[model samples]
Target chain A: MSDAAAGPLATVTLRVDAAEIDAFAETLGMPASPVPPTFPIRFLFHPEIRAALAMFLPADGSLPIHVGQRFRYHRPLTAGETLTCAVSATPPGGARPFALVRLDVSDGTGAAVCQAESEIAIAAPGFTWDKLK
Target chain B: MNPPRPGEKLAAVPIGPLDGAAIERYARASGDDNPVHLDPAAAGAIGLPDRIAHGMLVMGRLSRLALGWRSDAVLEAFECRFTRPVPAGAALTGDGRVAKVDALADGHRVILRLLARDADGAIAAMGEATLRLPG
Candidate 1:
């Protein structure tokens, strides 16, 4: 049962464009697609991916779902890059769930750039998930 | 007085009034309407109590605070731990203390360790940001 409780990791892959990355980069005052060696590629796309992966997790549809406790990603995401994101739960314990997610962003040549992990939690039941809409 | 050096303490910037519309706009702009960030109903159905703000939005605002320290500052590295949820329409604040200042061939740089707090002073998001300064 403990082994079963340690659910298998979930994996997802996404393709990102320069324009989309640029929009977020603009807020940071950087080019839409950062120049190679300018800034790490993980920073370029991890935020969005983090948010997306957070949503992918089920939380009973409640108002205050807090999933990420800690996140670590090292590498840069380039425009026209495709990232294969993987998430898995570490054995669940004591009122929270701990997991690690890795995002592999690669170019056409299959050269990898960014790898990231997020530590997330979903409060145990007893919250209202029906009123938020 | 000249603004505190990059590594020095800077003023705290408040967060919140987490407008749902703004979040929607960010979703539309980013093309990521993850139910948790966009649909309150979806968030609830999944057990989330309310609509939560996008983590990047909080980071963007905090980065603004860091840039305010120096005109030529360029973000070098930004990392954070999402500590708490920032419910929509609540007031939030940004706090930071400079971690280090570096001298580079192109310019001087400062690293600011920052955190966004709710009105109750609870951390909503915490992270570090590095910026390049004009020599």
Candidate 2:
């Protein structure tokens, strides 16, 4: 994809290994469910995924977030579950670039494990109030 | 007011200098194939020098800190807003405090206020979580 204004958007994918999932379940002290454990466990095993997304997306340097932006997650993973997470921007009202993301977890046999969606926004690095005005 | 839970305090948790393979591994796990995360050139187009981490991935880190305090507590709700970007190969630290703890007749629950930071001490993400603890 080119850096041009019209270049194709970027999307990142991350995988959750089974071994790591088990370790996470063990850490949380819950019997491994047919799904992957939520939150903290997702962090340790799939941190690289987080790093990759942050490299490009912009953020608020301080506190107080924008109204349209949010985050979300799904439940546990059964052994051998493959999750596909994606983040991108959409045209809100066909003008402003609105951040949107989704996660799709599934096993090879055509059954989905978990799915979620949330909004995102890319603030220009060193975002300035003047730019917004 | 009643006394706070045994070991409740706003604190920090440490994380890491993530490698490329790990990033790739997470991408596969989440089923996302965005080039910016997998391709350096794509990231550059977005004003990023190289591939970066996922926001949800950062939230996951924050979640770990929130849940780390108890052995059998189940997360009832996990929510946050990504405040900043966390670059690849950067060290991460997570923090949280007990916002509220309610003891019900059946069991007890706690609301944890959370924050995850990058090596630079930047608040990469912030949020709150509700966990259910049985007696």
Candidate 3:
């Protein structure tokens, strides 16, 4: 995808790997479920996507900080399905000076796999601002 | 807070001490290599005392609690915000409780309150989740 006027937009496709799913559960010390609810995050914000995010950072050298996240699912994504993710990074909102990165993951068949919204702090290192507790 | 019941405490998630190695493992596992979660120098440059665990890493603990609920229940939604920076290497505790339950067209909608705290007792992350259970 080309760069949008507002920010950078990138897309990538990946297959749902069962090993990856079980690893996520094992890492968290939980028994893997028949379906993973939040596994899409790994692929949606995978390393390359993170690089895409860095490109949109403020020219002042401020790095992005993840402040919050929300996940919605039509149904749990299972194995045997390939996913395509469209990630768009938007400049910080007016009231809050934080970037809102939206990621929409869909099955190859165009079905919604999961929708995730990430709130990132776009402040550069050493920048001063009221910190939230 | 008068008394607690056995059936009430559904899950006890043991968030192992989040250290650099562990954080790196999580970064590798979650595919989130945000420098802040892996580099203490970078985290310090940003005013954080040290490298901090990803908010999702802390939030994921709630899944254990969600799963401990009725087997028929399906986790429909989960939402939360980062309240404070949970420095890597701190022992974290996760607790979940049923806040409310309502009837839905397909099943019962169960709302569960989720909270994770550092060893110091400060809330690291908190949120609510909805589960649809066929009755």
Top-TM-score structure, candidate number: 3
Residue A113, candidate 2: alpha-carbon lDDT: 46
- Residue B103 lDDT in candidate 2: 87
Over 4 Å off, model 3: A1-8, A59-61, A127-130, B1-9
Per-residue lDDT of candidate 1, residues B2-45 (tens digit): 43354577788765556787677655554445667887776666
Q: Which ten residues in a row have the lowest lDDT in candidate 1 chain A?
A: A35-44
Q: For candidate 3, give the lDDT.
A: 0.73
Which of the two, 2 or 3, has more TM-score?
A: 3
| Per-residue lDDT of candidate 1, residues A1-133 (tens digit) | 0223443345456676566566555433444543322223233235554554454445544233434423222444556666565444443356534443434444456665544444434433464422211
- By the lDDT metric, which is better: model 1 or model 3? 3
RMSD of 1: 6.7
Least accurate stretch of 10 residues (summed lDDT) in model 2 chain A?
Answer: A62-71
lDDT preference between candidates 1 and 2, better one: 1
Candidate 2 per-residue lDDT over residues A14-78, each given as its tens digit: 45556655554443333445333352225322455455434434343311112122323334454
Q: What residue pairs are clashing in model 3? A: A62-A124, B18-B89
A63, model 2: CA deviation in Å?
25
Interface RMSD of 3: 1.9
Q: Write the per-residue lDDT of candidate 3 for residues A13-105, one digit (tens) a residue.
A: 878888888878776776666655656778755767867766776566455666778888778887767888889876765575666788888
